[model samples]
Target: MTIAEVSKKYGLSADTLRYYERVGLIPEVKRNKSGIRDYTEEDCRWIEFIKCMRSAGLPIETLIEYVRLVQQGDETIDARKELLIEQRKQLIEKMEDMKKTIERLDYKIEIYDQAVVKKENGLKRTYD
Candidate 1:
């Protein structure tokens, strides 16, 4: 299929696909006789994985490095696995940070509610 078809399949814009290719985040695409990009099933799968990893907050440079490692073939298998594992650890840390943020917000909200209640009581006392 072409770039358009691949973009439609993955819900990504054609420009984004081109940018990914240009940035070396994605491998070079195969071109057909018309010089249009010809995307294959493997390309689609790779794009999907990229989208997932990106959504999970993986950096573009990391993805690019991972792709480079992958291109190195079997020799870099362990390195690739380690990279993924490290990324997973970072994701967990981000999740914990988010959890802490939420907890802090909750605590602040509780204090705000107490202030509101106190204000209401003070108003009642003033009226009395």
Candidate 2:
């Protein structure tokens, strides 16, 4: 597929795709005779993997290291697993932090809701 097709398919900008390729986030995309990018299935897979990793808040440097290890072949399998494990741990920590923030927001909202209800009850009594 062309870069445009890939961009549309993946919901990423063409420039982002090109940037990913340039930064080694994904492997080099194959070029057609006209020197335009002709992404193969394997290329698309890499794009998907990189996009998913980025969505999970993985750092670009971490992804680049993972890709570099992937290019180095199967000898890096254990290293890749360890990298993924560490990233997963970080993601879980971030998730916990977000959960705490959400709980705090809920608590604040509940307080406001109770104040509003109390004011409404007072108004009702005054009108009655």
Candidate 3:
């Protein structure tokens, strides 16, 4: 497929795809004899994976480092694994905090429900 087809298929801007290529976020794309980017399914697959990681809150710099490590062959395997593990730990911590926040919000809503009910019953109250 062409770049436009790739962009539409992935729902990414043409410029973003170019930027990814330029920034080393993606591997060097093979071009045809006519100097057009002839994208293959494999290229598209990597684009989709990069898109997923980006959507998952992975930083571009981290992604760049990861791509670099990947291109370095097998020597950086341990570092890549450690990076993923660390990020997973952080994500878990963030999710736990979000869960606590949601619980607090639900608790507050319960209190607000009581206040509204009491107000409807003509039992006025003041809060400091």
Candidate 4:
């Protein structure tokens, strides 16, 4: 598929796709004779992986390193696994922190709700 098609399909801007190639986040895409990018299935797979990692808050440098390791053939398998494990640990920590924050907010909201209910009840008693 052309770059435009890939961009539309992946919900990424054309410029972002080009930037990913330039930054080595993805392997160089093949171009047709007319100089248009022709993305392959493998390229789409890389895009999906990169998008997922980015959404998970993985650092760009870490992703670049992972891509480099992938290009280095089979010798980097253990290294890649270690990298992924470390990233997963960090993501889990972040999730835990976010969970705590959500719980705190919920508690605050519940307190306000109870206060409102109490005030309404007091007002009704005063009126009656």
Candidate 5:
């Protein structure tokens, strides 16, 4: 597929795709004879993986390192696994922190809700 097709399919801007390639966030894309990018299935897979990792809040440097490791062949298998494990550990910690924040917000909202109910009840009593 062309870069435009890939951009539309992946919901990324064309510039972002170009930037990813330039920054080594992804491998270099093969261009057609006309000097236009023709992304392959493997390229799309890398984009998908990179998008997923980015959404999960993985650092760019971490992803770049992971990609580098992948390019280094089979010797980096254990290293790759360790990197993923560390990232997972960090993601879990962030999730836990977000959960705590959500709980706190819920509690605050419930308090406000109760106060509103109480005020409405008091007003009804006064008017009646």
Candidate 6:
């Protein structure tokens, strides 16, 4: 598939995909004779993996390192697993913080809801 096709399939802009390649977030893509990118299934798999990691808030520098490790062959398998584990740990912490924030917002909203109900009840009593 072409870059545009990959971009649409992955929900990322073409420029972002190009930047990912340029920044070494992904390995180099093979170009056709006409100088257009022809993404193979393996290339698409890398793009999908990169996109998933990015959405999970993994740092670009870390991802680049992981990609470098991958290029080094089987020796870096443990390193890659460790990197993923660390990122998952961080994500869990972030999720906890977000949960607390959501709970606070819900509490504030409930307070306002109760106040509005009380005011409405008072208004109804006055009218009656």
TM-score of 4: 0.93
Between candidates 5 and 6, which one is better according to lDDT?
A: 5
Estimate every model's Cα lDDT from 0 to 1.
Answer: 0.89, 0.93, 0.89, 0.93, 0.93, 0.91
lDDT tens string, model 6, 1-128?
99989999999999999999999998999999999999999999999999998998889999999999999999999999999899999999999999999999998888777777879888432211
Q: List the residue pairs that clash in candidate 3.
A: none
Candidate 3 least-lDDT 10 residues? 119-128
Candidate 3 Cα misplacement greater than 4 A, ranges: 125-128
lDDT minimum window of 10 residues, candidate 6: 119-128
* lDDT (Cα, tens digit) per residue for candidate 5, span 1-128: 99999999999999999998988899999999999999999999999999999999999999999989999999999999999999999999999999999999998888777777879888432211
* Pairwise lDDT winner, candidates 2 and 3: 2
Report the candidate with higher TM-score, 4 versus 5.
Answer: 5
Model 6, residue 82: displacement in angstroms? 0.8
Output the lDDT of residue 84, model 2: 96
Residue 66 lDDT in model 2?
A: 98
Q: List model 1 lDDT by residue over 1-128, tens digit each.
A: 88988888889999999998898788888999989999988788779889999999999999999988988899999999999999999999999999999999998888777777878888432211
List pairs with backbone clashes in candidate 1.
Answer: none
- Prediction RMSDs, each to the true structure: 4.0, 4.0, 2.0, 4.0, 3.9, 4.1
TM-score of each: 0.85, 0.93, 0.85, 0.93, 0.94, 0.91
| lDDT, model 3 | 0.89
Model 1 residue 88 CA deviation (Å) reads 0.9
Q: Against the true structure, candidate 5 has what lDDT?
A: 0.93
Better candidate number, 3 or 4, judged by lDDT: 4
TM-score of 2: 0.93
